[model samples]
Target: MGGKGHIFRKKLFQVGSEYKWLGNSGELKEITLEKRTGVTKELIEKRIKLVTTGIDYHLGHRNCEHFAYFVTGNMPRSDQSIWHMFTDHDPFNIQPMINNFDQLREALLRSKHCGPVGLSRGDFENAVFVSQLDDGYYTYHLSHPLGGQHLYITTVEKAKNFESSYNSIVLAYFGAFFGRGEIFSIVRQLRGC
Candidate 1:
């Protein structure tokens, strides 16, 4: 564990308190980020309550940037982790569940817009693919040969939830973090024909 994770997502929410310096010579710089939505003080407090038990910390995934972006909807990013992903990691294991999968593969191959996505990492190299089945409505799921939950990506709210779940699953299983890929993927998938 690194000391940088030293302060694992400390929540600082003093509205009128003075800024106390905590560095040798770190200069204070202020910049603005356009937010997707305004975050309420009540929401911030509620989220902060989840800082300990409800939040899982990961250098590559749920770093300070993600925490801020999630709460504020500003979507500020840390490129360091992503840079490391490209230079210091294995091939993007979109997972080989795509290969040698018989039952679900056949089923999805028959669907209108079926695709694939793995839910976890270790010992589950062969997971069901996330596919879309379209009739009048579209549905996204792993369509497991044995059955699993379908994550609907039709709305920003639902997509956000799926992104959170995907982040945890990918981090826990693939040993990698998605950063903002979850949101992008959801948006892209939602736009499918």
Candidate 2:
């Protein structure tokens, strides 16, 4: 590994098939739909073997981007490739408070992946009309018709921080890359989030 400035490549590719909320607001659902790569478990597993050989990476060739293409079959690419930003660890690096909740809603919608970046107190009753819970949390009142209504939950503290907060709602949901034993840090899955 490059020891912070150095880039690390996987000895092989690994992904899970579990269906969890892709982002705090299910951002990946939309992106995956737009994706046209068709793959199989067998193919992915086979490619996973290549990493153990330890090969050199070349730009637009045997690089990480190309490796992703081989594993995902999706024409590998990146969104924010500049990896030096430890900005996620500092809340101040993110747009402060966001002023009003209404502005937050607009920001959320305008967010890169239609996912939320952090928690803001808002009465977004559009999802489902549910009775407020005694603990301040509320549930969707399934009485109305189903419209892909879903809810995501996280601790109140993380809702207020960065790093983890990037995927909290959905501001450019890039999966943060991390090293072993690395602590509270930012992560992304390479192709921009």
Candidate 3:
């Protein structure tokens, strides 16, 4: 884990703070309070309170960044190593789950935007996935598959609620930590697709 990244992300979540977003590509962007949306101190606190028992922000953020990188393929380059620290910790048994991504995708299709998440038995308990349809509505799940040793899909609402406690914290942390301009740049690039 990059010591600099860990310290940076930690400071970003220190409450009432600001920082410049530095991309892994070495691009620099400014972040400020006036420009950020969908992220607030209240939301952070609320989400922090919702995490499952025994889970803390440290562990939760690790899980969140790992999943985000897996899905987005972006290594979160904001001078924050929450992403790096997350991977270093290897919070989830993701290595084994890579092959399971197909199973996850298939389960997602069957559930029609509601499931394909939740804890299964063993090291591969927790999971997360996105659900979207023709409607503008979209939701993401963080859960453990139910029953058996193999993966299964649970409802998005449940997964979302589960993630609300900590996953939301990580999202908000990155959003705030990276600031508005940097986020817009990334979002715009993503939308161009």
| Leading candidate by lDDT | 1
List the global CA lDDT of all models. Answer: 0.35, 0.31, 0.31
Which predicted model would earn the best TM-score?
1
Candidate 3's C-alpha runs over 4 A off are 1-18, 21-37, 56-193
What value of lDDT does candidate 3 attain over all alpha carbons? 0.31
Structural similarity to truth (TM-score) of each candidate: 0.28, 0.22, 0.19
Ranking by TM-score: 1, 2, 3
Model 1, 78-122: lDDT tens digits are 554663332221111111112222422343344443333444422
Worst lDDT window (10 residues) for model 2?
183-192
* Model 3 poorest ten-residue lDDT run: 169-178
Runs in model 2 deviating more than 4 A are 1-21, 24-34, 56-60, 72-193
Model 3 Cα shift for residue 131 (angstroms): 27
Cα displacement (Å) at residue 71, model 3: 18
* Candidate 3 residue 64 C-alpha distance from true site, Å: 4.2
Candidate 3 lDDT, 29-99, residue by residue in tens: 55553334345556555544433332222332344444334223334222344345322322222211112
